[model samples]
Target: MARVARTCLRSILKIVNSTLGLVGIAMILYGFWMLRVLQRDMESPSFDDFDSTALWFIYTFLSIGVALCLITCLGHISADSSNGICLSCYMVIIFLLLLLETLVAADILLNSDWEKDLPEDPTGRFHDFREFVESNFDFFKWIAMFIILVQGFSILLAMTLRALGPNNGSNYDIDEEYTSATLPLINPHSQTPPYVVGEPRFSIKNDAWNANK
Candidate 1:
């Protein structure tokens, strides 16, 4: 039962872990797609009119995607090996990432003027992002919720797997100190006789002071 539970948890963890990588790859492709779309929409496609903020959009998404993919790969390895240290580090990194995402989500939810605080985009690509989000608010909201739930569940699975420890189920382990060649044939304790109390044991005999006595 314990092994089955661990197997189930590990499978779930692997599935969740793979999702992060997929999302990362999607973001990477999305960044390129956004760039292509912007160029296509322009009357005169050129980099001269490209804004630093627009470039930032591409780089930022790509960087995030790479990082997430790396983390996801690590998660898969840790889950497969059931290494305690790897699981611990994975949990901590996931927790920090989750916390950052949560803060961002909360800021978006609570601060309507958040965009005003952002740097201006000369190319006005951020306006497109805002429009996209606003047009599909429900879809984005559900995606955000799903991401949060998966991240939280991943942390939990990491903890559980770490607690379960590695399953060294093979019967190959042996005590190296007691090989067949070094084992004793007789018990060491058997060489010594057990003590008993009796009058003969207490009585002391004396020899006469003669050479042949």
Candidate 2:
């Protein structure tokens, strides 16, 4: 019974960790896609343009961080002793990455001066693109912000669930560990109950004693 319980737990942990890892990867990909759009604007050159290569590097770093998180999750699922350390390190790294991304994205949205210093002018095409994004960037910024928030929340929940153990069932009961009255008797034909203690019924040497009594 204990073995089966552990096996089921292992399987659940594996699934949870693996799923979270894949989600992290997906988030990184999403970031890459957004960056591509921003890059496209930069290539044509915009006043609000950013360094596409630098942004690509940031996404690459985030991708690496996500990979680290996946390794930590794998350790947890495998029940390795080092899992705790790995998880702690990756948690901090993930949080920092989120913060970094948020700051960079905010700068891209709120600080036009910072954009002015960027190298989006291979041929001064960036000035034209800036005028275009200046009008539509707000909507895109809100959407990107929402996605980042949701992704972060998902990571937090996954971490909490992983720490608490497997999420097999929503409800758990300690009473189920004990045999209850509702359970069927194992040997109905036995006059003596399994858990009850009573006087000895008979002994070969006490046959005469019983008869006399």
Candidate 3:
């Protein structure tokens, strides 16, 4: 029954790791798409005064995408090898990433006063931007929340698979032999008999008898 559970856990780990790998690939592609958009925006004369902070934010996303791809590869390798060390590291990183994503999603969901800070513009660009963000807020929040949950699930699966191990327990025969070899030998013959402290010796008078004969 335990063996069956381990097998099922391993299968689940493999499937989850593969799915995460695909997600990493998708992130990479999305990052590239964002980069292309950023480039096009930068080439436009109207975007010459684009905020440097926004550009840095785009770079941060790209870095995160690349990091996800690398960690996904680690997870796949760990699953295939049943390497506890790699799985542990993967879990820790995923946990941290999950936390960060959750925080970002929470901030997005809870902060509703940003519109008040927007400067009144005659061009209506800020208004359109605000509308676009408002329209997509729920979608972004839900997606982030979903990803966070998946990451948490992955962490749990990794821990389970790691605990299952790779069937590397010591062989019974080998352990028996090792135990036998390490024991000290005892010799019963080497023990000394108890000695008497003082005892009178008696000798038979065989000589006197022979003289008499």
Q: Which candidate leads in TM-score?
A: 1
Task: Write model 3 residue lDDT over 69-149, tens digit each, in one string.
Answer: 787788777777778888899899988887777676567568877445434443333455458667998986686566666
RMSD of each: 9.9, 11.2, 11.3
lDDT of 2 by residue, 1-213 (tens): 443554554445455455446656765775566556656665764335444564543455467647746754644644333244444555565577578777887797698788665643443335544575678989866865664664465356435444654433423343454344434565465455576476565665598787889
Predictions in order: lDDT: 0.81, 0.55, 0.68
Mind giving the per-residue lDDT tens digits that candidate 1 earns over 110-145? 998888777666565667877999999999989978
Error of 2 at 209 (Å): 37
Q: What is the model-wide C-alpha lDDT for candidate 1?
A: 0.81
Better of 1 and 2 by lDDT: 1
Clashes of each: 0, 4, 0
Q: How do all the candidates rank in terms of lDDT, highest first?
A: 1, 3, 2
TM-score for candidate 2: 0.38
> Who is ahead in lDDT, 1 or 3?
1
**Distance from true location, Cα of 42 in model 1, Å:** 7.2
Candidate 2, lDDT over the whole model: 0.55
Ranking by TM-score: 1, 3, 2
